[model samples]
Target: MGKIIFYEDRNFQGRSYECSSECSDLTSFFHRCNSIRVESGNWILYENPNYRGHQYYLSKGEYPDFQQWMGFNDSIRSCRISPQHQGSFRIKVYEREDFRGQMMEFTEDCPNVYERFRYHDIHSCHVLDGYWMFYEEPNYRGHQYYLRPEEYKRYTDWGAMNPKIGSFRRLHYFQ
Candidate 1:
């Protein structure tokens, strides 16, 4: 099971709500979320209700502020735990859209794709197994894109405006 807590104030103060399951609408629980604590399992926090709007993927940790979760603002309206993957990690990135152009496959985390693939952008990708997180900056920083075992024919398919990907990391199941 997954466990998470949303706080109305930073440092886990003020009104708060604990969630162990999916929540379609969090308005009833709190007006806004400024901080969060994930005690177990990874979760995808949505900007709007019903899992709409932008998504912020979070692992087990404490986010003292919205920026820690890479949130544009303190407005988390919904959340859902990420399902654990039992298979090996496998992913392929393409230099062009629709899975075209040069390609690179990875079974482990890549801190800098440029070093390995000699590229700086990823237009498309295919995840064959496990979950992955694409970072806009190197060393797992900046905007994050959470990917499951699926196909993303273009950067837009993964909710990105441009194809500037610098690194990627795999999500591991805690239990």
Candidate 2:
């Protein structure tokens, strides 16, 4: 099981809500989320209800403010716990839509995709082993996208607005 707490004010002040599982709509519990504390497990926080809009990937840690998690705002309306993966991680990145064009396979974290793949745009991907997080900028900064073991035939398949992928890393439990 996993534990996470959402705070309505920064530094864990104000009204708060504790969650152990997936929540499709957090609006009933709190109007906004300014801070968060992940006591266990990994999670993905969504900006809009029903798991839409921007996404923020978080592991066991404390986020004193929304910006600490790289949030664009305090609107965290949904969340889902990422299942722990104890095995290896594997993913294949493609340069064009529908799994076309140049391709590269990765089993380890890539802080800068362009440094290894020689391109910043990854249009499609196949997650073959474990959960992964795609970032819009190098060094795992900017927008985040959570991906499970599946096929993403296009950028939109993984909820990305564009094909620009700067960095990527496997999602694992934090010590």
Which candidate should be chosen as best, given TM-score against the real structure? Answer: 2
The alpha-carbon deviation from the true structure for residue 170 of candidate 1, after best TM-score superposition, in angstroms, is 0.6
Candidate 1 lDDT at 27 equals 94
Look at candidate 1 and tell me the lDDT of residue 58: 88
Per-residue lDDT over 1-175 for candidate 1, one digit per residue giving the tens place of the 0 to 100 score: 9999999999999999999999999999999899999999989888889776667888889999999888989999988888887679999999999999999899999999889889899999999988998888899887777788889999988777789999998988773
Q: For candidate 1, what is the lDDT?
A: 0.90
lDDT of each: 0.90, 0.94
As a whole number from 0 to 100, the lDDT of residue 59 in candidate 2 is 87
**Stretches of candidate 2 above 4 Å error?**
none
Off by over 4 Å in 1: 50-54
TM-score of each: 0.89, 0.97
C-alpha root-mean-square deviation, each candidate: 1.9, 1.0
Question: How much RMSD separates candidate 1 from the native structure?
Answer: 1.9
lDDT of 2 at 7: 97
User: What lDDT, from 0 to 1, does candidate 2 have?
Assistant: 0.94
